[model samples]
Target: MVEGRPVGRVGDVDWLLTGSGDPVTVFAHGFGGGISDTRPLGSGVDGTRVFLSFRGHGGSGPLPPDWTYDTLADDVRQVADLHGATRAVGASLGAGALTRLVADEPERFERLVLFLPAVLDEPRPAEARGRFVALADALDADDEDRLASVVALEVPAEFSGSAAARTYVRQRTVALRAPGMREALRRLPALTAVPSADALRALRAPTSVIGCVGDPLHPASVAEALADAVPNAILHVYPQPGVLWNQRGDLRRRISEFLNSR
Candidate 1:
């Protein structure tokens, strides 16, 4: 249903391939996300794009008991191998997974783009953890009102107050009500830890890290720290999460410029 179809499976995971050209780009979405989350970035690129659903999310299979960032990263590596992809873009947990991939196999990718990376040196914030748990509870109860409240706490204040934003949140929550999602949400805290500082510092690819303000779970500070650690990384912090929705044209331009650069 996303922009591509099921080309094939990679180690119990489903992958979608779209567009066509050299230097295939892989787009991985965040926790509780699917191919749709990274659709914007996938379409922004001029070359081939491969979109993957992490274990238990989107079109992927149910979560395995041994699932970890390393496991998910291996799945990503498999997708790249299938298409001979040389570049990747990921957000939040997806970004974390890509981090692990590039760290383990630096030669697998030529360029990397990470957005709103949810991991850093610090532990997961208590409030953010609580929100995920609450959302799981809401989903189990099929409580739209409760889910809206939980999602609102994480959105930018301005966006949360908008009727359209609230509607979007509720609709998104409803669409995400897939089997095994509750278990995936529960395991998120453990699966989202950032790769080791040494691993980040050792990255050899041209990388760009984007973070947004007003997102407690994925703070700009985390992006700043990553940019500081990766020798060749550049950091871009959006003033607010709302800007991502209202100013997508600008965002597309920024991402296009990055992907097209030499």
Candidate 2:
């Protein structure tokens, strides 16, 4: 069973530390997601799992009065120190957080795995942000139809081709139908800043980035850019699209190899 404990309390932010084993692997979920999202990957890995649900995501509590990725990195550091994690895996937004964490404290993590990281170093399109806000509002209002429409718009096109992918989407959508999601989405503007390429290149930790072919939001170019920026960082392109987290076996193998090497 996955064990859990409260690590740090930053205002309303209460970071949770969980799992077992030496050289623990800390996991940070994507935007709007929580510790639960990392369960699958954590289960697949060998070491103890340390999962942190950022403020406004999952059971961690509401957003801080003022929030930024740097602050989130501090939260990650506190959680890692509390749980004694020597490796870290971050998915999507979490990946971006890990980048900042490893950049600031290279000795903390032995290995890092980033899945569909959001590191554009540029502003995302205004229309995309507007659509996300609208969806969040619709979710808050309990407008199911509007929520479904927003999901259709935001979900990558490849999700339509696979039954498993559709099922996963259905499950996630149901989970997101809950109340606090609107507030989580409202924090997107603050979470959207991209890390500098130079900073990424200077990272000393052994790192790997996984990209999906069909994910519109995190295209292959983004992963390639990250790989190029990070010294000796390996880039893996999965046949599937988007950040489903369950489509490929190569991800597990790569992470295992990277961690074992350290």
Measured by TM-score, the strongest candidate is 1
Clashing pairs in 2: 20-48
In model 1, residue pairs whose N, Cα or C atoms come closer than 3 Å (at least 3 residues apart or on different chains), thus clashing, are: none
Q: Candidate 2: worst 10 consecutive residues by lDDT?
A: 1-10
What are the per-model C-alpha RMSD values against the true structure?
2.3, 3.5
Cα lDDT computed for each candidate against the true fold: 0.77, 0.69
Backbone clash count, each prediction separately: 0, 1
Question: What is residue 140's positional error in candidate 2, in angstroms?
Answer: 5.7
lDDT of 2 by residue, 1-262 (tens): 2346645554545555555567788888877677767766665677677778776665566656566778678767877777688889888778877877776675677788888876546544455467667878877788876776676665566556467556655666775764556665676654543456776656777788888775655666777777787786888888766445456465666666776674
Error of 2 at 99 (Å): 1.3
Q: What TM-score should be assigned to candidate 2?
A: 0.81
Candidate 1's clash total is 0
